[model samples]
Target: MLKPIKRAVHFDFHTMPGVDDFGENFDASLFARQMKDAHVEYINFFGRCNIGWSYYPTKVGYPYPGLNGKNILGDVVRECHKLGIQVTGYLNAGVHHEALLRHPEWSKVNMKGETVDLDPQKPFNGNFFRMPCYNTGYADHLLAEIRELLDLDVDGIFCDCMLLRPCLCPNCTKEMLARGMDLSDEKQVTDFAEEQRRKMIRRIRETVPEDKYLFINSLPCPLTKDVATHAELECLPTADGYDRFVSQVALARPLYDTVVYMNGRFQCCWADFGGYKGKAAIENDFYDAIMNGASTCLGDHLHPNGMPEADIYRDLKEIYAKIEAYEPWTDGTRFQPEIAVLSTVPKLNQSHYGVGRILGELNYAFDILMPDGDFSKYPVLILPDEITVSGELREKLNIYLKQGGKILSTGTSGLMPDGSGFALPQWDFAYKGKDPMQIAYYKPTFEEKDLIHLPWECYEPGILLDASEEDTVFARHITTYFNPGYDGTHFNFYMPPKGETGHVAAVMNRGKNVIQVSFPLFKAYMKTFTKAHRILMKHLLAELIPQKQILTEDLPITARATLTKGEDYTLLHVKATYPEIRGTMGVIEEHNVLPAGRTVAVKGEFSSACLLPDGTPLVIADCAGYTKITLPEITGYAMICLK
Candidate 1:
């Protein structure tokens, strides 16, 4: 059932006593009505919050000081369950204000012997949450709270901020010393802390029944593979940009049966009481999540009166009604991914996000696959910048190449595990060290017309390459003599190019279906958005995987297009929303309109093509063995279902 969560909302009731309440004006019927109006099947209500106070009548942990014997949590759970909506209990595990106040020693101790919390010297300067070290006796107290909350009959438990940062508390230091480990070593301390975090999750799992799901917030780092029951990515696109919604979802969806995109309704993050995102912004986020095969969970904060904010729920109801109508097309659908970006060394530098972004912008269906994943299913494999390959992985790639698997390796990606030299010899390209220029440029050898001198904006260098006769060079790196600087004589307007075009920028080993770029193409694009970056990537991708399932005309970079296959039809989700950086906050205050002249080309046979929700047939024309379908004027988001 894909973890039994489809449309949901996360109530981040992390409130303080003076500013928070306990169902003072909360009406059960009104609460159930709001949930039903929103069409949410699951909800993450608060049993506890970061301030270390319980909502339900609790005996293990401290209840809200001002609650006055109100079982608000139990009351909400009963109401939501009665309305046929599942509830996941929330526990603010990392920052327990009450625990820190009761046992000061349990607070996380930095190397400087300072507890990690809001700095007294600066107001709102440091992190507001006071993290408690899980390695200490605080773990036992947290577990006791979890067990106490389990008796409330929740469908699941979500432990928030469960990560264990580098701790130097007395308990942690003593354990490290006993293990014969150096306390000064950051890696050892961090790894030990991570193990302790996992141990706590295991303890929670053992305490809970098998049917109840236990999820740790931000658990992608330690429990990436098999530890978590489901996948949930905390993608606050407004804070991190809308591109992150696709990047994070693509990375997590392939690994888990169900993926949930947790985004806040605030302009940036959680705990903004009056901050409300525009209707277009919320709709775009929800559409993007479902298009990428993820369930949607909009995060919101309750008011001090324990009442569901009427304005937020009013907008949510309409947004989720649209989602409810589109769920039939999204559910049980398989996303056809033709490209895989390998995120081998996630700890070092992984360009999955950059690669995924570029691929999506170009209307390519792709997935971010780990190094150990089976790459044979994908026609093209992208080894993004700085992905060092182990001996075992190198062998696997070598064999996969012989089986006609295509590879697009970027700068230093095919390097040996120790970062010495190239592990795959089929490319027949030798790295001639990093380019000495501050900002290099790409010169396409074969182009329709003369191109602008696209400056490699960032200070990152490109590796000079020497290709053998077996490889064909499509582009060359243009190096500059030196960076122009302000001097006494005159400030140079521009730097002069070296005019030496011997270094190879991009090469294609057609015999083995391998394409290698000497520069860190994906990383460069991530750092700076330049036409040159997209131009070169597009050229290389076209040469490697020319045939595409879908193509679009006049598609904006702000708009993302995804194609998924249902049992009897194909679903196309076109989402576009312009989010301007308004006064240091990234928000979509206005909805951008999509012109009517835009068209989508599908490379498949369909009996009929029509716009979704209304079932209006579109004129599908045959163009070069592809079906071209014209799109209507879209205001924010549109879904096209082809049968």
Candidate 2:
């Protein structure tokens, strides 16, 4: 098997044809030395960029006009090899501008009979805007380029922009017709495109040796797990933010043995020259990767002059050096989650993002699971908004519930395939279609009313549920006076609550293990970021699984905590640096040093507790069923190990 990537760099070199000084100051030895200095174990260099310009002299493709005769790809591979660093040649598989321009017939034609492009208005704005059909001769040309990269003795091939996009090109249409698939049906066209993409991936995987790495980017991780050697989560925090990365890591960890979290050094996003993120922000990304049992791959764009920004390497050296120190503890550790959230879809969606963010903020260790995931492993399973329980999945859930597994479902989750009622008999409530009111209010029971503001406005519509006599109503729904709309002469800016409707908003069955919330709380929380929504979720989760794995005292809501288990020890990671929203981006420039009064109570019987790497012993005390440890003053991030 190929070795796992610990610390890697994704060097993007997508230069347009008009660049005059492309690779003019190219120094392969200097580039390798810089990467080695930053403690990079693997480097993904460019073999063929999206602009359809090969970095080196190629027999099958167009070389960069400014390269003249210099074989930059070959030189970098040979130099990086001398430093014991692995390398992967990157090829833009989907969007090849030069190739599409050369052979316009290879371009994918959409249903509108227009070529598939990112922006229909600006057809020639960017190199990546135009997409080429994979079923055409372009596939053969791409494979020939891959063969050239393999002959260069690189470690592997990394194919970018490998997405399944529906096409109506002549080649695709002919293939669909031959297969007796209806070209008019959108689903059939999409399925055919998926098959074509997969066929190409299979060919590439077959060509690559078993010992070499192969990564197909832009596809769902589970769909490509068998063909792709490892999972690369390409999430740039500045553009995509932290929630997407967190959710993707949770989804990818269980499928692949080696998962690499790819973030960029750019302040904004990819290909931003002279843009740099703060040291603390980059450190947080790397720490998040290791804490979640994944490797790190920092992204950087090579300047058109073929020189790397010296400051990027300087920051990486400090951050990666810290990661290297903690590798012994994090190398093979697995996440120890106390809860599993049954995802509404196979891919990452708003529900997953909301649940993951809320759970992380609440200091709860959880995993995002598919419908077929092992629900018995977690103490509680969450069916987020709109999880359709098929017969097979319902059987699995029933078995899990019988084995004392708790379930917290919201919105339309747990509904029957026909949407008649709840699939699980334990949920003693009748689903009475969706409420007509677009904006409703939630009122907690008297006992829990002080938790948050009563009559909390729900921005989105929710399902109406009638709880059975055996069910305990925890919260009631309050109807609005009227939805915010113009009624001829009168217009309302916001909907005002019109007294309680006596309908159940949140309820628990007699078993006390199954709790159901009528509203689409996950989606509402994601879209509105309402504190009440998260508060209600936290309260319900506590009621479901009262004995949590990790409990914190005096920890701020902005801080995040996670638990991972090694062979001989359990690791607790705490991060306190919160990103501040500036303009359109979340920027993290400063680290918050928490005071020393904070304490963490872990539900385990470990004999000793100590800080990681430095081996600083902490004060540990044993409670009835938990171990309480007084943490040291933490700045940005800290890890504790219990044995």
- Evaluated at residue 142, the lDDT of candidate 2 is 87
> Candidate 1 regions off by >4 Å?
1-3, 20-22, 116-129, 221-225, 345-350, 417-419, 448-459, 483-494, 510-512
The CA lDDT at 274 in model 1 is: 68
Query: Residues 1-643, candidate 1, lDDT per residue (tens digit)?
Result: 2255788888888766775544578776678778988888888888888888998788878888877887777777788889898888898887788888899898887756678645587543333446788877888888888887778878888888775577888888898899999888888988888887778777777776778876778555325455566766777777767667676666676777778888888865777776777677787777778778888888888875757777778888888888888877788887778888777643323366677668877888887777778788988888888777767888989988989888988887787766556787776787676666656776766653224554344335767777778688877777776666668887766876666458777898748488888778877777786666677777778787777877875678778788888888888878777577776667776678898868888887776888888898877788886777888888888889988
Q: Which residue runs does candidate 2 get wrong by more than 4 Å?
A: 116-125, 178-185, 446-450
Candidate 1, run of 10 with poorest lDDT? 448-457
Pairs of residues at least 3 apart in sequence or in different chains that clash in candidate 2: none
* Residue 166 error, candidate 1, Å: 1.2
Q: What is the C-alpha local distance difference test score of candidate 1?
A: 0.76
Best by TM-score: 2
